[model samples]
Target: MKNFRMRVWWFLCVLPLLSACGGTEVTLGEDEDVAGMKGVVERIPAPYGAGCGIEIPVEASYLPDPGVCGNGICEDGEDMYSCMDCAVCGDGCCAGGERSWNCALDCGSVCGDHFCNGGETAATCRADCAPKLGSVLLQRVRSCRNRFPLPCNSTQTRSEFHWWDDFNVAQDKQKRTYLAQPFNPGRDGVRHLVFIIAGQQDGDMASGLTGQRDGFKDAFRDNDGSMWVGVDGQSLAYRLMAEVYRSPDDTFMGLAFDARFNYGFTPSNKQEIENAYYEWLKEKFYASNLRSIYLAGHSRGGCLAARLGRRFKQDFPQVPLILHIFDGVCHVNDHEFGTNGSGYLNPLMNMNGDWRAYSTNVGAQFPTTQNLAVYNMLSGDQVLGDFADYFVSVHAFSHASPSAVTPSFTEGDWYRQEWFTWTHNGMAHNTVSDALWHYQLSCNRFGC
Candidate 1:
């Protein structure tokens, strides 16, 4: 990354007239001929038969005029000037003599447009050079993938959609800020967030929130600094229905149907989502200014957050994604919870239990892992549990009389309350926007 130093000098040619006094004609000197050269030298021709010094070769691109040189002699078809006696005129080539100059309308022959000097050649210089600008040609190439229109990489599926250029939010939105408000817009240390929505929609879900446009737009308006992406896990599964059976609505509870299908969401899908997410994430936020990312979610959403954290250090291996889980679960354990505080959630495992019972039962599967935070509020308490487990934090609150009061509610409880109660059956769970608000509040309150 060494910078080049440049200094261009223009020299005017001069010729002396010979008089009846019979003074000796002078030849050009190397010192006078070479106006702006570095690292070499030669002798010059003097009057009264003095030998002219060695001449230096100049670039032909800036050729001097042949009209009047300092040699003081008009020989052949050329005009000349005195080289030995005239100190006022530089000693360059005289008429009919060998000479050189570094001047040209096109220097492409000598050096390419963006030559070592860093300036464009005449033929390439434009009023604005932003488009032609390229990053410091990275030494290594990075891999990227896309997540939507499921059967993502299946050989059986043939998709008509073709999206290239490697999805990069940061690079594409150059100078443009995203997710602006709650988090100050244009802040360099912004983190990236990816949301993987998992659920079987028997109701009007996709219509209520256009997963791609409205969700992303609202997320951006709320906190436009971080990069955001969403993946429809159910859609992906439905697309791969040949591998698994689609559950019948009449066979299970609303939450049970989701848990039965999405709870078992495979690691393969998780890997694919993370792969595509960061491939584009890094390209967009690779600047030195980028901050660490925060992975988060709700029910199925929270599970995705955990899966990403667990394999992040393996799949993307190099990227550092901060793990944040909100009311999420991983897998079902048979450690009798009420029997020994392990599989106590077995009571609510009924396919026909209330939605709350299903949520609590699901929480058991999502125990606090070393890399993930399983945040959950106790059945009826307003205070969250051991959610502050270094990396994981949880909050519990009851919908009963006093606990439902906002004043008696904890901030974490307020989060879930506001989120689950946002729209239809908590279908409008905008983790990106929620995370942004929490991040802004946290930064403001604790200087995080």
Candidate 2:
């Protein structure tokens, strides 16, 4: 009875303490008859019960929630504990490690991607590569123009021939134009005329005359005696005539038309351009008193010079006609030369005349006949390989079929070939003018 009373008292005392810590720990009977029974047991919270103030039951080894990833949405197959599991590859937006070459379908061919994929050329995407042939030609043209300005302003005598004051332009109904400039005009009837025809879309008469003036000045500087002829005390004797055509647009068609028709001679007339050249020539000089005539041209202009030279020889057989061709394009059809094996043979080369041809050996690819004296100028820069292939060809001489008749077989058979250390197209074209001036100076000094 005494022990039972003591146990009741202790149970009442412990019951209050056990009720106070209900969710934390539970105490069973001190000595229970049940198997595997303990004195005290930890109270595990219910499966969906609140433990640390939240409803979600967590294990001791549970990692913290990583939240959302990439665009803030917990995607399927993503690790609930990791945000990096949602990463995707080859996204077109260049996101998620997509590259232009590797994943071009998504990245589009953007520049600076370190890959020269798609239509990104060296000119368009220069950061990754070198310039292409087109870019090289463009740069060469710009550099040439910059190096040689329009007018020959380098010398005092050449500067006097201003475009507005000294030059006269004549335009026909077909819009074909030509310019005439008298270099040393005087009352004396004796005159030596020089006709300069520039390449397609090059420039107007001013540009041609400027090229001529610079060429003459360079020749005179080299050899003064033969170049300067005195018709009388009043005049230096040589005048310039240039056929100016329309400027080309910024498109390929414009370039083609300008090269084919604008600078080319008419198939029907053959004596002049489609429009004003013949009429303008007649109005400028009296044919009876003219001493001699020199015809010079560049590219397509060389074709025109050849055609006109043939006609001039037919018309004025007694007067001497000298032809100077500068990097002349050969085929009658401008486009056909690039396609066919016709080479650079032009009707001009076929014409029987005293000829002086100039070309840049850097780009000359065609085989030229040994009909005339050829000056092949080499360039240090070889970037214009395509240009050289298309324009400048390997010059081969053929003595079997001479284009022009010689006074003496020994003298005429001589190959007058010179190589200049120059590369630019402008420099190559301008070299003819320089040669002419030298020839004139030599003639004047030695009495030609």
Candidate 3:
């Protein structure tokens, strides 16, 4: 019995050890199954910890499911968690149940789209809308017009007007510049031509021809042949004369001379220069058909025009002529406050045609004379005012006699002295442009 007791005690002690060893063997198989089922279980942690620890083998199949879309969430099936339905996956339609704010990838905010969305403005997206008037005009001046056409007979025809071609460009005297335009040979009636002299600047003709005044030039070229006035923006005028006058063979002429050569004092050679210009005009157009001539000049060119006008009146006494001068007057002295000379005064008196002069109110510098229609535009700025005051004081001593003074002269019919808030440059450069715009608008309604 004692021995039986001893054996039972021994068995009792070893029983826990045997049971632990058996548990170890079973755990090994379970761990192996857990590791092998990791991928199938979607790497989800077991509900009881360490993934099905000591649980039944069937429980391994019931491990928590992982997020199919990799969003770190547990869901029912692959379909619900699939990225195919997500709005961020670059689908054209933002219809994945997502708003633009939430999913910008699908609904981009860009310009040039048909819709004016994404903070797009008319300026930014002009392709989708129209701009304002000021912007439109600004843009028009910025772009250059190439091969501008003459509007005629309901048809468009392109032509080039070389405003500087008539000047002595080449040293070779044989190379003479000629004026020609498409004319209706059968048309009949007298036509008018206008000449516009540019200011004292090199390449002013080229600038006038190809720059800001291109549209203005086009207006002249496109006008109907009946009483059409050809405006030459620079010296050396040429145009295709239309025979729309009473005499079918008669041709009217307008010439704008580049007074580049008459820069400084040319008292002795002034007459010779004037004669050359007259000869050019006579050679180009029949002097008999020239019923009227309109001569215009800007700056020093105006002084030259005034001198030339005196000569023109003497040469073509029958041809009624008009002088349009801008900020130009001859002075005995080249100094700013010099006394006015006969070169400028004689033309004012002798020119049998209308006289219109546009200038800034620089006191004595601006010629104020009888028979001279002067538009003395005041800038109204303190700087110009002070300058004018100084100019008047310098020449105040020279005007002791009423005849020698500008204010004493008889005011022409169109004499106007007005004040404007514009700049000096604006008043000087844009006067002709403004006048041309008004004249063209009127010409469209009434024959020029």
Candidate 4:
């Protein structure tokens, strides 16, 4: 009860700052663009007709044929296929013959510089890579874990835990009860942190960072990277792991949505999830006099965070919701929303204003030819239209780092690509991770 009183007092003290404080004071003029990582106002393509939309061809070829393999052939009609024999194919069998359609025993395995193996082939291509889907996805998820840690990973101890779908405190339901065995370092206090909402990768929230979290907690005696956890908050935990950041961020937040989609946790579910999260946070820290809350997510999670921010506006509008969407954009059919997503067109004219999705991205080298529909469907989306009034598309690369492969330079910036080519290095996406955080603090530091 005493703790509850402290919380109320803390809320009163912080409420004024949140209600009156604003984000960075960068004036977003009509002609002036929102700044990019470098402080240059971002040049958001004008609305479709206004000159901001890209006229992407709506052809079937752009869609991914995951079932098909090599040079566009799927004769097996049922085999899971993969691309093989590229110079970078790590199997040391790159020069081997007739290796086409063979199982990509090491498709996404990153040994050294190149991304060897793991392409679609005629013989092994199954509809879902049956028996192997879990393995393959798990490997990818681990890769992501290996690369990004600070902004995402945690080294907390474990115990039998349960993920709360919704908080029902009345029933004595610990609401979002997840048994965190506590970190070894045994430190307690709110600290500077970031959250990476995992995408199709990183199924388990508590698995990946167990070891790392321990290290940080031992050293700093606090979860310095903030609190990295999975999205669905279910599963054995370790299955979902992918280092989407070949170009690591100073850190990351893995959401573990790899299997969540299979369930019915749609965009609408975001509000509930976020509410629970905030409630849990307040329950845990507000009384301790913690700092402000800032949230960011990529792809689907990014979309979710954006809407979550809008909802949070009613309570804490001053908090900055820094959302970074890689390839995950939400697209509602014109019939559904009564609008177009392209900036030039009134893509969102009929939109009902319910934009929410989690982070998702297509690898530069591991191009997902099957999920093109998802990207196409969401491209030029206008869901976060006004909600993202202060959004910025940070250091985007043509492809994942090291390989320096460009997906399509016909769109977006030339600087990142140019910077990569000249340096002959994989560009880091997390370079600007702190930029937004720093900017937000600066914006409010002087009472703005």
Number of the predicted model whose TM-score against the real structure is largest: 3
Span of 10 residues, lowest total lDDT, candidate 3 = 133-142
Question: Once superposed on the true structure, which residue ranges of model 1 sit more than 4 Å away at CA?
Answer: 1-204, 207-280, 310-424, 427-437, 445-448
Of candidates 4 and 3, the better by TM-score = 3
Give the winner by lDDT: 1 or 2: 2
- In the range 1-448, model 3's lDDT, one tens digit per residue, is 6544433432333223333211112122343333133222122111222221244342332211122333333235532112222323344443222233333354444444445555554546543332211100100001122333632222111112211223322221111111222221221333443444544443323222112232323332222211222343321221111111111233233323234434453454444445445554444445555555455555545555555555555666655545554444444354322333221121223432112222222233333332223333223222224566355211111221223223223233423333333332343454554334323333333333
lDDT of each: 0.28, 0.33, 0.33, 0.26
What lDDT tens digits, residue by residue, belong to model 4 across residues 1-448?
A: 6544433432333223222221122223364221222232211111111121244222201111222322233344322211211212233332111122332342222232122346522223322221111211111111111233344342222211112234322111221122221211111343211333322222233222111221211222223222332222112111111211111111122222321221124434433455654553333333233233333433344344333434433454333232233323232231111112222211232332222112222222112221111111122222223545236221111222232222222112111111111110111122122223333343254221
Q: Cα RMSD for candidate 3?
A: 27.6
What does candidate 2's lDDT look like per residue over 1-448, in tens digits? Answer: 6544433433343334323322334345566422344464433222121112234334312211222233345476443222222323332232222335544554456677667776775557754343111100000000111122353222112222222122232112122222223232432443455555555543322123123222222222211112331111111111111111000111010011122234233343332232234343433356676655555555555555555554565566655555554544434333212222222222223431112222222112223222222222222122125566466442211122243122112123212323233332453343644545534543353232
Pick by TM-score: 1 or 2, better one: 2
Report the error of model 2 at residue 84, Å: 95
Where is the poorest 10-residue window by lDDT in model 4?
419-428
RMSD of each candidate? 22.7, 30.5, 27.6, 30.1
Clashes of each: 45, 19, 12, 72
What's the TM for model 2? 0.34
Question: Against the hidden reference, what TM-scores do the models get?
Answer: 0.29, 0.34, 0.34, 0.29
